[model samples]
Structures are given as structure tokens and as C-alpha cells.
Target: MDTVKQSLKEASIFTHSQERPFKCSDCGSNFKRAADLREHERIHTEERPFSCSHCTKTFRTSSNLRQHQRVHTGERPFTCSVCGKGFTQLSSLLKHKVTHTQERPFKCSDCGRGFKSSGELMSHKRFHTAEGLFTCSVCGKGFNRSSHLQTHQRVHRFKSSSNLRKHHRVHTKEKPFPCSVCGKGFTQLSSLLKHKSTHTQERAFQCTDCGTGFESSHELLIHQRVHTGERPFSCSHCTKRFKRLSTLRIHQRVHTGEKPFPCSVCGKGFTQSSSLLRHNVTHTKERPFKCSD
Candidate 1:
């Protein structure tokens, strides 16, 4: 009974007092209670005492661990009264409530970016700080996030990772997507799907100039360029022009002296994979190609 009265007296004293006696040695942040200061110190020490039972993930606090556990258990204790949308945390529910009013209470001082919640503002503020900045080693360019930096580092040509990966396939000749009909490999899934349409005899796109049917509109457009003599892709080193981008890339290798494809047997390199594949057959004595008499 005396301990309960003493705790209540201490709580009352804390409310009336403006000074925070407990101070964190790491960040120099003051806290009203010693327990709060101990929790704050975990940020500097990188200590995560609380762990999730379902996964290998750990948290500094038990509350954070509980919130993460809700993801695995599919538990949403906190729900918005307006939309009845369930959320794992009360903070998420409070943020969802502002969506109903369309209110942006938190605003960024640096960029003037407005956010519905303070958590979003805090994340946005990290973009202006060095702690959250991701620098590209190639160009010495800085990005707010690692994903943005990775996308930017794709020879500074592609806008997205998927687009860069597709373009990389042109040089690497990495055909992951395969057509089950003819067992032919393609770089893109869309190309594989288009190849499958040829097996089905489904040609939706037709060239107006040549009257030749193609599996896709893109293929039809490229075919039309042959009849029109429209060389869209041009060589950087020479006055040579090509109908396709792949051809232009191959032509550029002539000036650059780039041999990407190398023979595994003799370590000799070639500009094209077709040249390396033909050279590979010389070792095996495979005479698949012969003049018909």
C-alpha cells in the first residue's frame, strides 16, 4: 500500500516538474524516467532483446516485436471506426483516420512535401540527411534510397531495374523465358508469349506495306521499317544505320572492339554469340550444317 502511494506521488511530481533528471550518455537526450532512457540507449547499442517467435527477426522493444508478430498471425487489434479497415498498430489506424478527412498534418521543411502522418514525414526527412543517402560509386551521384541508386547505376540509360535487365539480356544473351512449343528461348516473357501465338497460328498484327503477319504490334512495326527503309538506330562511330537496336549495338562493338562472347575451349573471344557457337562446333566436329547435293 505504501509502494503504490509512493509511485503515485512520484508520477505526480514528474507531471509538475519540467526538468528531466535522466539523461542518455550516447545521444545526450533527456528523459523524465530512467526506463525511457534505457530504451533510448538501445538505439545506439543496436541491441534487440525482444525476438519474434514465428521468425528470425528481432526488435529493440517488446511492443515492436508484438506488432511484427501480428504480420505472421494476421492479427489486427486496432481498427478504424470510419472504414472498418484493420491495422496492426494504433499509429497506422490513426493515420488511416486522416485519410477520411484528407488532412496532411505533417509537412517536410526541406522539400515542402506533405504527409498525412508524422511517420511518413520522418521517413521523408531522412532523404535530406546523410544517414539515409545512397551514393553511386561510378558517377558519384547520390540517391535517397538504395533501390533508386541501383536503378540509376544501370549505365545511366534505363529508368527502372526491369527495363535495365531487359536491355542487359541484349548483350548477355540470357534467355530465361522458353517457348514450350518449339523449345526456343527468349529474353522477355512477352516475346515468349508472342512466340507461342505463332504455334497457335494467331497473328493479330499484320504489316500494311508487305502484307506479312506478325505475332505482336512491335514485331509488325520493326518489319514495316524494312520495307520503308527507315533506319531508326544509328551508329555512334560511323555513318551506318540499322533497322534494329540490337544490330546497332552489334555494329558499335566493331568500333569499340568489344568481344563479349568468348569460347570456353580455347579462351578466344568473338563479337557475337553466333561466332562463338560456330567456333565451338569445330572442337566437337559437329557437321550439322552441310551443302545439300
Candidate 2:
């Protein structure tokens, strides 16, 4: 009886190990769970059985489909104890925790710029290195990033012929970035800074890798990506590549046709405008309505 019990325990352990029955024919990857295997198979099969009742969106996994359906249901269950706010997904709530902690773990080794999120820091680093990624098929105006390219395309999309003619001057001009060291002018600040680094030879941003330094930490991060080859930013529309997710998002907007920002005064909507500037009499502390001097 004792031998039979031990054999049954061993058999249970073996069964646990052999639970994954599906194998990826293309990659020869084996999954430990059947549900995970199904999800993996859907990648090749393009099978989205689980769907949102609110929208026409579908998902291969039930969890993703459930999250989508919540948006239509207006149900955000994950509430914050600190702010008393709610999030539909736990990941969002975890991101919100960064605000309270005030922690910026991701730092640029080149420029020493800190960001609340990796997303923001990644965007900031792009300014240091001219990663000419976003290209225009219309007039062949190449950009270092796709977000800028998308914003530029809006000019072609909505601008009149005269406006397009006028915008060409901005392209031709040599005044995008000004030098901080010598007050010299250039079309790009990043190039000017790289030049300044030669004069000052200031490798202010030091890498965590080998303590190797550069003029901007973004350059270092971009360099590090070469080692890891982790392209987190993927094209939602296609298999196109990008360094940052925001660049991918702006690119995705090109296909989805979603623009939410609008001007309050002129009713003009822009994807990226400097600000909504309202005229104020700063010289005087006079309010006609309040009767205060």
C-alpha cells in the first residue's frame, strides 16, 4: 500500500511536467500550460474567439477580451488607496504608484535627464541622438522620429497650398536648435551639443554597463538597445519598427483616425501644439469684475 501511494505521488509530479501538449511547429517551442499554448497558437492562426460585447474588438486570450469589454461596461475596479482613484487594469494602478514614490529608476547616462516613466525618458533621449526613423512617402521629408513625422504630415493633410508653401521655409531654415555653450545657431540642437562635447569633452552621462560615457544618455540607451536588441515599440498597424512606444502610438493614429486635442478659442485641433496661450494683462493687478485693485 505504501509503495502504491509513493508511485501515485510520482505520477502526479510527472503529469504536472507533461501538462503542455501543444508545440509550436514553426519555432519548436513547448508551452507548460494548455491555455498559454492556445494563446501562442492564435499568434500563427490569427484566431480571436473571445470578443468584446461593447465593441467589435476580438482577442485570442479571455483576459485581454475581458479587459476590452470593461471599457464599454465603464467598470474600473482597481482603486487606489492613496488617491482613491480607479483603474480598469492592475498594470495602470502599478504605474500610478510611481507618482507617490517619486522614483525615476531610468536615467539618461548622456544628459542626466530623469523621467517619471520609462516612456517619457525614452522620448526625451531621442532629442539627443538624431535617429532618422520616420520617413515620408509623400515628399520624402525624413525625420529622426515618427512622432515628428506624423505631426509634419498633418501639415500636408490639413494645410492649404499656401500653408504648405509657407511651411517649406521651416524645413529650409537653420534655426531649430541653438547652442547652449557658445550661442551658435544650427538646424538641430543635438548636433550642436555633440560639437560642444568635443570642445568641453563632457561625457556627463555615464553608462551602467561599463561606466563608459557620452554627451547624452539617450545615445547610451540607444547603444544599449543594440546589445539587448529589445524593440519594445512595435507597429500596431504592421511589422514596422520604432525605438519608442509614443512614436508607434502616433504612427498608429495615422491608421485609426483618432485626434482628441482641440483649441478652446479658435476651435483649432492639433496633435501637438506648444500650448493654449490666453492673453492676460500681467502689468496690472486690476480685475474689473472683482472690483479689486
Against the hidden reference, what TM-scores do the models get? 0.45, 0.49
lDDT of 2 by residue, 1-293 (tens): 99999999987886778666668886778887666777798888998999777767789888898787777888999998899889999988877777777577668878885655555555556557754445788888777556578787877674587556545646787465667767776655556767688678889887776778878877788767766777878876867777765667756755543333434543323334433222222224755466457
lDDT of model 1, residue 53: 88
Pairs clashing in candidate 1?
none
153-199: candidate 1 lDDT, tens digit per residue: 76777789899889999889999998887889999998898889978
Candidate 2 has its poorest 10 consecutive residues by lDDT at 274-283
Off by over 4 Å in 1: 1-7, 108-134, 143-151, 156-293
| Local error of candidate 2 at residue 56 (angstroms) | 2.0
What do the candidate models score in CA lDDT, each in turn?
0.80, 0.68
After superposing all C-alphas onto the true structure, candidate 2 shows an RMSD in angstroms of 20.0
